[model samples]
Target: MKKVNIIYWSGTGNTEAMANAIAEGAKIDEVEVSLLAVNQASADHVVNSDVLALGCPSMGQEVLEEAEMEPFVESIESVVKGKKLALFGSYGWGDGEWMRNWVERMENCGAQLIDDEGLMANNEPDDEAITNCKELGEKLAKA
Candidate 1:
Protein backbone atom coordinates (compact mmCIF):
# COMPACT_ATOMS: atom_id res chain seq x y z
CA MET A 1 0.00 0.00 0.00
CA LYS A 2 1.12 3.53 -0.68
CA LYS A 3 1.52 5.71 2.37
CA VAL A 4 1.01 9.45 2.31
CA ASN A 5 1.92 11.72 5.19
CA ILE A 6 0.60 15.25 5.43
CA ILE A 7 2.54 17.53 7.73
CA TYR A 8 1.48 21.08 8.36
CA TRP A 9 1.51 24.12 10.61
CA SER A 10 -1.53 26.32 10.88
CA GLY A 11 -1.78 29.47 12.86
CA THR A 12 -5.44 30.12 12.13
CA GLY A 13 -6.74 26.64 11.44
CA ASN A 14 -7.04 27.36 7.73
CA THR A 15 -4.11 25.22 6.71
CA GLU A 16 -5.17 22.53 9.13
CA ALA A 17 -8.54 22.41 7.48
CA MET A 18 -6.79 22.04 4.14
CA ALA A 19 -4.70 19.18 5.47
CA ASN A 20 -7.75 17.34 6.77
CA ALA A 21 -9.61 17.75 3.53
CA ILE A 22 -6.60 16.51 1.64
CA ALA A 23 -6.40 13.51 3.93
CA GLU A 24 -10.07 12.80 3.36
CA GLY A 25 -9.57 12.86 -0.39
CA ALA A 26 -6.41 10.81 -0.28
CA LYS A 27 -8.15 7.88 1.36
CA ILE A 28 -8.23 5.32 -1.42
CA ASP A 29 -8.23 1.58 -1.85
CA GLU A 30 -4.47 1.28 -2.10
CA VAL A 31 -3.39 4.34 -0.19
CA GLU A 32 -2.97 5.01 3.51
CA VAL A 33 -3.05 8.61 4.65
CA SER A 34 -1.97 10.25 7.89
CA LEU A 35 -1.93 13.81 9.17
CA LEU A 36 0.46 15.32 11.66
CA ALA A 37 1.25 18.76 12.88
CA VAL A 38 4.69 20.01 11.97
CA ASN A 39 5.82 19.95 15.57
CA GLN A 40 4.76 16.33 15.88
CA ALA A 41 6.43 15.14 12.67
CA SER A 42 10.01 14.37 11.85
CA ALA A 43 12.27 13.62 8.91
CA ASP A 44 11.68 9.91 9.37
CA HIS A 45 8.02 10.41 8.53
CA VAL A 46 8.98 12.05 5.26
CA VAL A 47 11.51 9.33 4.46
CA ASN A 48 9.03 6.53 4.92
CA SER A 49 6.11 8.01 3.06
CA ASP A 50 5.40 7.41 -0.60
CA VAL A 51 4.11 10.95 -0.94
CA LEU A 52 4.51 13.93 1.35
CA ALA A 53 2.13 16.88 1.53
CA LEU A 54 3.26 19.91 3.45
CA GLY A 55 1.15 22.90 4.50
CA CYS A 56 2.03 26.19 6.18
CA PRO A 57 0.75 29.71 6.00
CA SER A 58 2.82 32.48 4.48
CA MET A 59 4.66 34.11 7.35
CA GLY A 60 6.45 37.41 7.57
CA GLN A 61 8.03 38.64 4.36
CA GLU A 62 6.23 35.90 2.40
CA VAL A 63 8.22 33.02 3.80
CA LEU A 64 7.46 29.74 5.52
CA GLU A 65 6.58 29.50 9.19
CA GLU A 66 9.99 29.88 10.75
CA ALA A 67 9.24 28.29 14.08
CA GLU A 68 8.65 24.70 13.01
CA MET A 69 7.76 24.18 9.38
CA GLU A 70 10.86 25.86 8.01
CA PRO A 71 13.18 23.85 10.17
CA PHE A 72 11.38 20.64 9.34
CA VAL A 73 11.61 21.41 5.65
CA GLU A 74 15.29 22.14 5.96
CA SER A 75 15.80 18.88 7.78
CA ILE A 76 14.33 16.93 4.90
CA GLU A 77 15.95 18.80 2.04
CA SER A 78 18.58 16.13 1.37
CA VAL A 79 16.02 13.37 1.57
CA VAL A 80 13.46 14.97 -0.74
CA LYS A 81 15.43 14.56 -3.95
CA GLY A 82 13.36 12.50 -6.36
CA LYS A 83 10.45 12.34 -3.89
CA LYS A 84 6.88 13.19 -4.75
CA LEU A 85 5.73 16.30 -2.88
CA ALA A 86 2.63 18.44 -2.53
CA LEU A 87 2.37 21.85 -0.87
CA PHE A 88 -0.68 23.81 0.28
CA GLY A 89 -1.32 26.80 2.48
CA SER A 90 -3.45 29.83 3.38
CA TYR A 91 -2.34 33.40 3.04
CA GLY A 92 -3.72 36.58 4.52
CA TRP A 93 -1.92 39.04 2.26
CA GLY A 94 0.28 39.40 -0.78
CA ASP A 95 0.36 37.21 -3.83
CA GLY A 96 1.33 33.59 -3.38
CA GLU A 97 5.00 34.38 -3.50
CA TRP A 98 5.65 32.10 -0.54
CA MET A 99 4.17 29.04 -2.19
CA ARG A 100 5.95 29.87 -5.41
CA ASN A 101 9.28 30.17 -3.68
CA TRP A 102 8.62 27.02 -1.73
CA VAL A 103 7.75 25.09 -4.87
CA GLU A 104 10.91 26.30 -6.51
CA ARG A 105 12.98 25.36 -3.51
CA MET A 106 11.60 21.84 -3.44
CA GLU A 107 12.06 21.46 -7.18
CA ASN A 108 15.58 22.77 -6.93
CA CYS A 109 16.20 20.06 -4.37
CA GLY A 110 15.05 17.54 -7.00
CA ALA A 111 11.68 16.89 -5.39
CA GLN A 112 8.82 16.33 -7.83
CA LEU A 113 5.92 18.62 -6.96
CA ILE A 114 2.52 17.25 -7.84
CA ASP A 115 1.31 20.77 -8.55
CA ASP A 116 4.11 22.96 -9.79
CA GLU A 117 2.70 26.07 -8.13
CA GLY A 118 1.41 24.26 -5.08
CA LEU A 119 -1.96 25.29 -3.58
CA MET A 120 -2.86 28.56 -1.93
CA ALA A 121 -6.00 30.11 -0.46
CA ASN A 122 -6.42 33.73 0.51
CA ASN A 123 -6.91 34.25 4.24
CA GLU A 124 -9.41 31.46 4.56
CA PRO A 125 -10.16 28.70 2.07
CA ASP A 126 -13.53 28.88 0.52
CA ASP A 127 -15.38 25.89 -0.89
CA GLU A 128 -13.48 26.05 -4.14
CA ALA A 129 -10.16 26.15 -2.39
CA ILE A 130 -11.11 23.15 -0.30
CA THR A 131 -12.16 21.31 -3.43
CA ASN A 132 -8.87 22.16 -5.07
CA CYS A 133 -7.00 20.83 -2.08
CA LYS A 134 -8.87 17.56 -2.35
CA GLU A 135 -7.99 17.37 -5.99
CA LEU A 136 -4.38 17.99 -5.13
CA GLY A 137 -4.66 15.15 -2.61
CA GLU A 138 -6.06 12.80 -5.22
CA LYS A 139 -3.18 13.69 -7.51
CA LEU A 140 -0.72 13.05 -4.74
CA ALA A 141 -2.28 9.70 -3.98
CA LYS A 142 -1.96 8.74 -7.61
CA ALA A 143 1.56 10.07 -7.91
Candidate 2:
Protein backbone atom coordinates (compact mmCIF):
# COMPACT_ATOMS: atom_id res chain seq x y z
CA MET A 1 0.00 0.00 0.00
CA LYS A 2 1.11 3.54 -0.64
CA LYS A 3 1.74 5.72 2.39
CA VAL A 4 0.85 9.40 2.28
CA ASN A 5 1.59 12.08 4.83
CA ILE A 6 -0.33 15.33 5.22
CA ILE A 7 1.36 18.02 7.24
CA TYR A 8 -0.38 21.30 7.86
CA TRP A 9 -0.47 24.58 9.73
CA SER A 10 -3.73 26.36 10.25
CA GLY A 11 -4.43 29.52 12.19
CA THR A 12 -8.23 29.39 12.07
CA GLY A 13 -8.84 25.76 11.04
CA ASN A 14 -9.65 26.32 7.38
CA THR A 15 -6.49 24.69 6.16
CA GLU A 16 -6.94 21.92 8.71
CA ALA A 17 -10.32 21.15 7.22
CA MET A 18 -8.80 20.98 3.79
CA ALA A 19 -6.08 18.65 5.05
CA ASN A 20 -8.63 16.29 6.53
CA ALA A 21 -10.58 16.27 3.29
CA ILE A 22 -7.44 15.46 1.39
CA ALA A 23 -6.74 12.54 3.67
CA GLU A 24 -10.29 11.32 3.25
CA GLY A 25 -9.87 11.29 -0.51
CA ALA A 26 -6.58 9.46 -0.29
CA LYS A 27 -8.22 6.88 1.92
CA ILE A 28 -10.68 6.10 -0.85
CA ASP A 29 -7.75 4.97 -2.90
CA GLU A 30 -6.60 2.63 -0.10
CA VAL A 31 -3.57 4.71 0.69
CA GLU A 32 -2.29 4.71 4.22
CA VAL A 33 -2.56 8.27 5.46
CA SER A 34 -0.88 10.15 8.28
CA LEU A 35 -2.17 13.59 9.15
CA LEU A 36 0.14 15.69 11.26
CA ALA A 37 0.41 19.26 12.40
CA VAL A 38 3.53 20.85 11.05
CA ASN A 39 5.22 20.61 14.42
CA GLN A 40 4.20 17.00 14.80
CA ALA A 41 5.48 15.93 11.40
CA SER A 42 8.98 14.52 11.42
CA ALA A 43 11.64 14.38 8.77
CA ASP A 44 11.71 10.60 9.01
CA HIS A 45 7.99 10.37 8.25
CA VAL A 46 8.43 12.63 5.25
CA VAL A 47 11.37 10.62 3.95
CA ASN A 48 9.53 7.32 4.36
CA SER A 49 6.25 8.34 2.79
CA ASP A 50 5.40 7.66 -0.84
CA VAL A 51 3.46 10.92 -1.20
CA LEU A 52 3.39 14.21 0.69
CA ALA A 53 0.52 16.69 0.97
CA LEU A 54 1.55 19.95 2.56
CA GLY A 55 -0.92 22.58 3.80
CA CYS A 56 -0.57 26.06 5.20
CA PRO A 57 -2.61 29.25 5.13
CA SER A 58 -1.28 32.54 3.88
CA MET A 59 0.24 34.51 6.71
CA GLY A 60 2.13 37.74 7.24
CA GLN A 61 1.95 39.38 3.84
CA GLU A 62 1.33 36.24 1.83
CA VAL A 63 3.91 33.87 3.21
CA LEU A 64 3.97 30.50 4.95
CA GLU A 65 3.50 30.16 8.67
CA GLU A 66 6.98 30.78 9.91
CA ALA A 67 6.95 29.34 13.39
CA GLU A 68 6.58 25.67 12.50
CA MET A 69 5.81 25.04 8.87
CA GLU A 70 8.73 27.03 7.58
CA PRO A 71 11.25 25.05 9.55
CA PHE A 72 9.61 21.78 8.60
CA VAL A 73 9.73 22.79 4.95
CA GLU A 74 13.39 23.62 5.21
CA SER A 75 14.17 20.29 6.82
CA ILE A 76 12.53 18.41 3.95
CA GLU A 77 14.32 20.30 1.20
CA SER A 78 17.14 17.79 0.70
CA VAL A 79 15.05 14.73 1.53
CA VAL A 80 12.19 15.52 -0.83
CA LYS A 81 14.27 15.49 -3.98
CA GLY A 82 12.46 13.46 -6.64
CA LYS A 83 9.57 12.76 -4.25
CA LYS A 84 5.95 13.32 -5.19
CA LEU A 85 4.54 16.37 -3.41
CA ALA A 86 1.28 18.32 -3.42
CA LEU A 87 0.77 21.81 -2.02
CA PHE A 88 -2.53 23.15 -0.68
CA GLY A 89 -3.51 26.18 1.37
CA SER A 90 -6.05 28.86 2.20
CA TYR A 91 -5.41 32.51 1.56
CA GLY A 92 -7.14 35.62 2.84
CA TRP A 93 -5.88 37.85 0.07
CA GLY A 94 -3.08 38.77 -2.31
CA ASP A 95 -3.95 36.61 -5.30
CA GLY A 96 -2.40 33.35 -4.07
CA GLU A 97 1.07 34.48 -4.95
CA TRP A 98 2.26 32.61 -1.89
CA MET A 99 1.08 29.27 -3.18
CA ARG A 100 2.63 29.87 -6.56
CA ASN A 101 5.93 30.87 -5.04
CA TRP A 102 5.82 27.87 -2.73
CA VAL A 103 5.16 25.47 -5.59
CA GLU A 104 7.97 27.00 -7.53
CA ARG A 105 10.33 26.68 -4.59
CA MET A 106 9.46 23.03 -4.12
CA GLU A 107 9.94 22.40 -7.80
CA ASN A 108 13.30 24.10 -7.64
CA CYS A 109 14.23 21.79 -4.78
CA GLY A 110 13.59 18.82 -7.10
CA ALA A 111 10.29 17.66 -5.64
CA GLN A 112 7.76 16.73 -8.30
CA LEU A 113 4.44 18.50 -7.81
CA ILE A 114 1.44 16.44 -8.89
CA ASP A 115 -0.51 19.27 -10.55
CA ASP A 116 -0.80 23.00 -11.09
CA GLU A 117 -1.38 23.85 -7.42
CA GLY A 118 -4.12 23.98 -4.77
CA LEU A 119 -5.43 27.14 -3.16
CA MET A 120 -8.66 28.00 -1.38
CA ALA A 121 -9.74 31.44 -0.32
CA ASN A 122 -10.52 32.90 3.08
CA ASN A 123 -12.21 31.07 5.97
CA GLU A 124 -15.08 29.47 4.15
CA PRO A 125 -14.43 26.40 2.03
CA ASP A 126 -17.07 25.83 -0.62
CA ASP A 127 -18.18 22.46 -1.94
CA GLU A 128 -16.30 22.74 -5.22
CA ALA A 129 -13.10 23.71 -3.48
CA ILE A 130 -13.44 20.78 -1.13
CA THR A 131 -14.00 18.48 -4.05
CA ASN A 132 -10.91 19.82 -5.73
CA CYS A 133 -8.92 19.27 -2.59
CA LYS A 134 -10.15 15.70 -2.43
CA GLU A 135 -9.35 15.13 -6.07
CA LEU A 136 -5.89 16.51 -5.50
CA GLY A 137 -5.39 13.95 -2.78
CA GLU A 138 -6.68 11.16 -4.95
CA LYS A 139 -4.35 12.13 -7.76
CA LEU A 140 -1.40 12.32 -5.40
CA ALA A 141 -2.17 8.87 -4.10
CA LYS A 142 -2.38 7.52 -7.62
CA ALA A 143 0.82 9.25 -8.63
Best by TM-score: 1
Candidate 2 structure quality by residue, lDDT tens digits, 30-132: 6899999987878998899999889999888888999998988998898999988899989875788889889999999999888756556566577887888
User: Candidate 2 — which pairs collide?
Assistant: none
Give the number of the best model, judged by lDDT. Answer: 1
The residue ranges of model 1 lying beyond 4 angstroms of the native Cα positions read none
Task: Give per-model TM-scores.
Answer: 0.98, 0.94
lDDT of 1 at 9: 99
The residue ranges of model 2 lying beyond 4 angstroms of the native Cα positions read none
Q: Quote the lDDT for 56 in model 2.
A: 95
Question: What's the residue-level lDDT of 13 in candidate 2?
Answer: 90
